[model samples]
Target: MPADLCPADAALAARLPQGVLRDPAPAYLEEPRGRWLGQAGLIAAPRDTAECAAIIRACAEARVPVVPRGGGTGLVGGQVMSQGPAPLVLSLERMTAIRSIHPDEGVMIAESGVTLHAAREAAARVGRQFPLSLASQGSAQIGGVLATNAGGVNVLRYGNARALCLGIEAVLPSGEVMHDLKRLRKDNTGYDLRDLLIGAEGTLGIITAASLVLAPVPAETGVALLVVDGPEAALTLLSLAQARMAGGVTAFEMIAGQGLRFLAEAFPEMRQPFPAPPDWSVLIEVGLPDGLSAQAALEGLFAAGVEAGLASDGVIAQSGREAAELWALREHIPLANRHVGAIANHDISLPLSEIARFIADAGAMIAAEGDMRINCFGHLGDGNLHYNFFPAPGRTREDYDQYRKPMTRRIHEMVVARGGSFSAEHGVGRLKAADLAEWGDPARLAAMRAIKAALDPVGIMNPGVILA
Candidate 1:
């Protein structure tokens, strides 16, 4: 704990509105990974932007750390400040109002507390689609989604959280509310604060509400699971699909055979497409125009892939139920990973050209270190892969604790060398702070530090996060 830092005092409590304060419960202190346990001086759930600003003002005046929390589904330690002076954990649970929905204009203004799932439902109710989809959409809030700039399955077609968001309303570090949630698609304004805070991970400010962009639902959509020879074949097939589809590919995800086996081991009853999982496969989804047939498009893609020796066997979804079933298998992968504990989990991204080499080389490198299982899979179209390491059968993750740091360093080193990011999709929370310090470019690091110092002069916002 810092010497000058203080927890919320009696004065701080009096500053907040009645019913805003709550007990610092265990759920507020824990993250999804169970890697670190946080300590909270207090927990506050403000109902609106004014109350949120008041909470921040009180914390700022008290020189207390303010850790903004949303769904707590974040993999990294951003939501929880494990070691520090106990912070006022600001929860965005009460600000659930969808202020306005402009479906005709293809936009919606929503408070930060609205869950991604709820936002999606609201968009659907108006005959539109909010394209940002995540496995934890039901729990993940819009604030946290933009806070971390989350990337999900549909990033190939629609883009990430940052791209989907048109503007944001946030409470800056000084307790002033930034009410710039404009629904404009084009704004060449000076110093876009919305972008500044979108991926800031609560380091600069707390995002309170946002102007979310909506897209028309695709007229025709189809899904197929294609068996590829390897990552190389998968990349080639992706190129061919793009050339043919002309921006119709909604999501192109690559699944490792090992991931399938892990699913089978963890979920024995779950129905999978293939009789036996191949070494490598891809789950390609296409969304076509009204006149185009999604089934015919996928069928043609499959045939082309087979003729090019990129795919050997596959399964194309016939109905929406079948499509959901196919997607269920992909969505359950993370749950299955948690079922079988992992030694080291990496959410990395690489150049499309380098993914194959990195996968093969990194797999061999990790194998040489110790006995471990690898379940590598993710949004291949976006070059992000959840390359996770697990214990060999009959062993526990505890057995490989010694190799965790060294093996992780090796993997990250290879990724950095190949023009890739060690922390991709998942923000650089407390987990990757050291990596950012060590591997970050000197000039960029200096600018980040300068920005942090200027915006959060008191260092009360998410201390020891990206800067440390």
Candidate 2:
């Protein structure tokens, strides 16, 4: 077990500009899902990279475990330390800064503490778009987003967080600064360490700042909600949309009727677009160049989908306000899910060819387990789905607690059998470490262990994460 934070560490904390809090508040101890309540010996929020390095150095010398926290919006409990010796929870909440923005070069350097929404607004000020978006954008910080290598609605066009980031400045486990924040698109100098830290869940090091790529705002943007028969038809519609619009398809999300129902039950004030929700529908967005009209492109795609028998009914946004309403429905699905409660939630990805089959087989498999409700939706353009199981109308999740593990295992088994990943966008953290051990490649696991040992010899950076 690692040594606990003692009185001596207090002196070390005082050296930092933001200082430290001995008594951690509820925010530091709790996760979004309320799955795990963490324990911390000390809470240190550093203002800059140097103070962060100093805190890490002190923890390294004392062999004290350090848990790097961002905005605490992680679903996988990566930001929480629940077991082992008490840890010093290092937060980057105070490091919020937009260091620079070069609109001509299409690059922006931002401190890790800046929220995703803030970053987006910063980019918008210069007529550029930071395309990495998520439901938790208002609170999810850059450090956490890059740590987990987040993938959101715009991934179909903009790619994941890793692809959006050009370079990063992180503090190593050994307290050394890796100042590799460059605005270049190509660099093959040596090993790509920036990628190694991103998606490492702060187990490797703390990402302090990043140089991110920006894109010009779309000349013409359009959103449409189309009713599909099922996942199979949705896949077919995706193909048709992509073929018709070419690279203009920016976001394609599949939503089940259950999600719409959940929203009605959870938030009655939120307006529903359709009078009666279809069994299965897709939210599609297309961004066209100056000469092309997004509305015309979507109408063409919709007509093709109708002729192909992939779509039954659809509605294309007529104005910007209507587009915002369309996206609000998609973005609020998670909130609805949380309000209703889930027995088990899965963020998984599969090969496009196998997604339809997996969804059908998995649903049948889960139905046999119990009479549960499933809200299946997500970024169909990229093959990632949020498959969550909820209790029956009159039941609660606590009543089904005994079956959570078995249900999760069964779903994961089906996913793996169908050439899918159990953890897609969400990193392993402590929640999926055992899943990684069970499903991860043996050689790859061994290599990861070696890399962790090399970078964090003392095991001070986020113990009990990724590798079990």
Candidate 3:
């Protein structure tokens, strides 16, 4: 590394490959705020692990803040550059290459820039499945998913991104490359350092590559929509369905009647999953092993729900296309709400038993606030819910924006009081840093800060992200 890599230089005439330096004023923003402003700085697109380490080393020596960005699809401002003499953005978008896939070992290694879609496609080509499916998979890079420790709809059984990962390759703040990409199932090491980097949001280190765990592709899938009286009944149906579906229960989501209505209005072609509208409905998916049928499992679960009166109405998808269509309804609700100008959205999780109580209580509280339309629905099987509030019937976006913080604060407090987490899937990026400071346990906060300080002593990598 050289000492001339200062933040002031437009382009430092370096001895490295010309592909590493990028000279352009790219667009940057702090989302959750969605403020897009001009970001003038040099960018680096390192080709390999050594180049990545060199870039970090140069940035650290120069005392320049380095923000590791991947796909820029993160909900929080984790990828944003809001401060510091136009920080250098080290993007891994160019290092996308599937290194190898070992079906027998059930592991695959790929560079950070590889999209989730590409990774899964590679796995599929090899007759394996990378089951971490998220909405942004089309554009989201594997590095971003691993850095944020993202969880998606299928997390009911497959677990989150961290659970699906076996090994990680990251560039430490001191410019040392940690190549811990071993395919071991169990390693009783001194500490789980890979887990530390998993959800650090690029604050600790830059994840350049990862070795991920793969599952056998499901031979068959059964999809169904069950309408129940309310969230409590939804939970009952989930309990019964889980008992029968076991590992096959891939997704167990809850949709409120109002959310379904919005989806219908927004997407006219989408068929409602239920015959009659109920206050709440659950979308359950069962994936069987090779040569096994999920139909039997789904049918038995439905019968039990109907007989017990936990489910009032339901429909089992007759075909694969129908099942995909039903899932589209659930997945596209967020898009529909975005189109309707949703000013505030909370991705939260509560205890399974307390979901009903939280929904009822939160709905009443939000309703009391003048003219707010709430869209509260999501993964009921695991207690995660996307509780969104649109601007009061006819208010401007600005009006809604002003009240977002207060509304979110109250709602988050209620969620905390109910023995639930304020953030379930979406991480504590710049948006929730303050809330984290306030609500996070003091001992835990201190420990996290200690780790952050030790990892990046100069506070360079994604400063002001998850920790102070």
Candidate 3 residue-wise lDDT at 224: 88
What residue pairs are clashing in model 3?
none
On residues 1-468, what C-alpha lDDT tens digit does candidate 3 reach at each position?
A: 323455354343253355687655344333433653424256778999999998888778777788888888888778886756677778888899899999988899999999999999999998999999888889889999999999988899888999999999999999899999988999998799999999999999999999999998788988988888778888888877777766678999898877887777688787775654567888888888876678877778888988998976778889999899888888898878876777688989998888888889988997887677888888876789999888665575577666778889999999999888888888887778898999999999999999998989988888888875
Better of 1 and 2 by TM-score: 1
lDDT at residue 426 of model 1 (Cα atoms): 90
TM-score of 2: 0.97
In model 1, residue pairs whose N, Cα or C atoms come closer than 3 Å (at least 3 residues apart or on different chains), thus clashing, are none
List the lowest-lDDT window of 10 residues for candidate 1: 1-10
Best by TM-score: 1
| Tens digits of per-residue lDDT for model 1, 1-468 | 212224345557777777798765799989998999998877899999999998888888889899999999999899999787878899999999999999999999999899999999999999999999899999999999999999999999999899999999999999999889899989997999899898999999999999999999989999999999999999999999999999999999999988899899999999998899898999999998899999999999999999999999999999999999999989999999999999999999999999999999998998788788999999999999999999999999999989899989999999999999999999999999999999999999999899999999999998988878
Task: Please list the C-alpha lDDT of all candidates, in the order they appear.
Answer: 0.92, 0.92, 0.83
User: What's the ranking of the predictions by lDDT, best on top?
Assistant: 1, 2, 3
What lDDT does model 2 reach? 0.92
34 Cα displacement, candidate 3 (Å)? 2.4
Provide C-alpha RMSD values for all models, in order.
2.5, 2.3, 2.7
The reply for model 2, stretches above 4 Å from the true place, is 1-23
